[model samples]
Target: MIVSLIAAVSADGKIAQSAEQSSLDWTSREDTRFFISKTKEIGTVVMGRKTFGTIGKPLKDRRTIVMSSRTGIEGVEWTSEPPADLVARLEREGVTRMALCGGAAIYDAFLSVGLVDELFLTVEPVLFGDGVPLFRNGARINLKLLETTKLGDSSVLLHYLLLK
Candidate 1:
């Protein structure tokens, strides 16, 4: 499976104001728009439990996979497996591609295991003095910038390929 991570971060590289806060609440409209459109194209989105809680339910017309130690979500799939096993399971299920929409830790898990094939990030204009970071416990991986484009008046979108 091709795993891609997508996130919108503050100028200081934070995804939220705090662990309790949601990036969707403060991220730019441009980033939201881009995220929605991209996720629609991808069709499958995998995120951590907290990330799923922020959204509160499965996204319409897409398969939502939540990574958690617990089991049994009614509408979406739940997994407690390691990132590599999860990716293998997804591949077995015939998923060609998936979006790793985040709450930081999930991003680190996938990236640390070297499963992320691509990363799309939107850099918003505002800064958070302290917040949840974009990635935690991640490895230092080489990235090849695929594209950089201005999203709005102050935001920018960066697309990168994780060098294998």
Candidate 2:
């Protein structure tokens, strides 16, 4: 599967102003529209529990998978499975593409496991000097730039492929 990590980050590399802050609160309308379109095109999205909590519900028309220890979510699938195992299972089930929509730890988990094939980051104009970062656990992956798109006058979408 083509696994990509998608996020809208601030100038200072922060994904949110707070743990509960939604990207919709800070990202541009263009970025939001791009995110929705890209994820829907991918057909599946995986995110950590806290990220899901911020959104407060399942995203329409996509398979929502929350990586949580607890299960039985009404509209989404909940799993505690490791990133690679989950990706492998999804590939076996014939999923061709997936998006890793994150709140830090989820990004770290997938990237650290070397399962992410690409990154789609929308860089917003603002900066949060102190806030939740894009990668909580830190990652050391090199990327080759694939594309750069102007989401708006102040927002840019950076697309990159992971270098193996």
Candidate 3:
């Protein structure tokens, strides 16, 4: 299966300034619109449990899958840490491609396992002094350029093919 990572970060690579999910408000309108557009390209999306917790709900008009060890979450399919089984289930469901919209840990997990196919990043203008890094514990991985587009006044989206 082909997988991709999509996210927006500050100039210095911070996903958010604080633990408050609402703190992502610093992200630009153009970036958000681009992200929404990208989502329409795929029918299913895969995200970490923490990301779903931050967002509060599944995105409409798409089948959302959440990776988590526990259950009882509404509007989401719970998954376990060893994603091998979860990935098999997804394949059985005929999911050809998936995107990773994250909170860092998920990125690390997928990257470490060599599952990511592409990386889509929106670089914003401003930078917070300190905050959550995009790939907190992810090991170094190489990528080949796929596409790049500029957005608004000070934002750009860079797409790269993940090198396994």
Candidate 4:
């Protein structure tokens, strides 16, 4: 199974303004395009409860799974322990490639479990004075370079693979 962590962060690693969950509009246009393109390659996406709330519904043309303690949501599969178990369940459901989309907490969850096989990072050009971090607390995992690319005017794609 290929578990991917996909996100756009500022050059300094902040994902959004600390006080605002809705003010991530400055990440940049090219980066957004680049991110969509990156996500197109995956068949399923896993996100945190908050991230799913922000998106409002399941994404089109892909199998979407939201992780949380609540189990009965129509579109969500409950993900409680060893977050990797979520990935495994998804794989059982015919999802071979899954991307971890985030509001920070989910990204950290996937990272902590060493389930991330690739990281599709888009480095936006602007920096926020204060913002939510891309990750707060998570387990340590090592990585190996897979590939890198220059997307456009101000965005770069840093792709990596799990070391193991």
Candidate 5:
């Protein structure tokens, strides 16, 4: 299965101004529409518990998997499984692709494990100055540019393929 990381970030590389801050507050409507379209096409999304908390509910029309120690979420699947194991299981279950929707640590976890195949980043026009970054662990991962498109007058979407 193919795994991709998707996020809307500030020009300064921050994903959110605070833990509670939602992307809807800063991202353009074009970016939001693109994100929804892409994830729905992928059919499944996995994210960290904090990321899930920020969203407050399962995404409509997609399988929501929260990577957390806690269990029994009413509308989502909760798992503390490692990245590789989770990916393997999903592939076994016939999932063709999945998106890694994150709050930094989750992105780092899958990227560090070398599971991510692509990245879709929407860069907005604002600067957070200091906030949650796109990747918390700061690991070096190479990527080949695939495509770039203007999301709106003030934002750009960057697509890249992971270089293994």
Candidate 6:
């Protein structure tokens, strides 16, 4: 399976000011458009419970999977399985592509298990001073830059291949 992680962070590498705040409020419009377009293309998005809560609902034309200990979430698939198991199951089901739509812990879990193959990041121009870091407990892994593109006037999109 081709697993990709997509996120927009502040200049200081924060996803949001707090758990209550949405990154969409501060991220650039170009990043938003890019994210939406990519999600539409990929079709399956996996995110943590808190991240799913912030979004409020499942995205259109996509399968939403919530990686959480708790269950019974409506309109989405809820699983407590680790990232590797989840990826294996998806592969068995013939899902060739998936996206790690994150808050933080999800990113760490996937990266820790060496499931992330690609990373797409949008670096916005603003600074949050203190906020949620992109990868809270992720391991130090190397990456090779695949491409970089300017988004709008300030933000820049960076695509990298995770070095195994």
- lDDT of the candidates, in the order given: 0.89, 0.91, 0.79, 0.73, 0.91, 0.90
Which run of 10 residues does model 3 get worst, by summed lDDT? 16-25
Question: What TM-score would every model get versus the actual structure?
Answer: 0.94, 0.96, 0.90, 0.83, 0.96, 0.96
Q: What is the descending lDDT order?
A: 5, 2, 6, 1, 3, 4
Off by over 4 Å in 4: 19-24, 71-82, 138-140
Give the better candidate number (3 or 4) by lDDT.
3
Whichever of 1 and 2 has more lDDT, that candidate is 2
Go through the candidates in order and give the clash count of each.
0, 0, 1, 3, 0, 0
User: How many Å off is the CA of 6 in candidate 6?
Assistant: 0.3
Better by TM-score, candidate 5 or 4: 5
**Model 6 whole-model lDDT (C-alpha atoms):** 0.90
lDDT of 1 by residue, 2-115 (tens): 788999988899889877777778888888889989998999999999988888889888889999999656999999999999888889989999999998889989888889
Per-residue accuracy of model 5 over 1-164 as CA lDDT, tens digit each: 99989999999999999988878888899998998999999999999998888788999999999999887569999999999999999999999999999978899899888899999999999999989999877678888999999876888999999999
> Can you tell me which runs of candidate 6 are displaced by over 4 Å?
none
lDDT of 3 by residue, 53-84 (tens): 77878888777888877874678677774656
Query: What is the Cα-based TM-score of model 5?
Result: 0.96
Residue 48 displacement in candidate 4 (angstroms): 0.8
For TM-score, candidate 1 versus 2, the one ahead is 2
Model 4, 1-164: lDDT tens digits are 88888888778888776533642466666776665665677867777777776667676666677778776457555566567666666668787788788868888777766677888778778777677787677445677878888877777878888786
Q: Which stretches of candidate 1 lie over 4 Å from their true place?
A: none
lDDT string, candidate 6, 26-84, tens digits: 88889989999998899899999998888888888899999989975589999999888
Candidate 2's C-alpha runs over 4 A off are: none
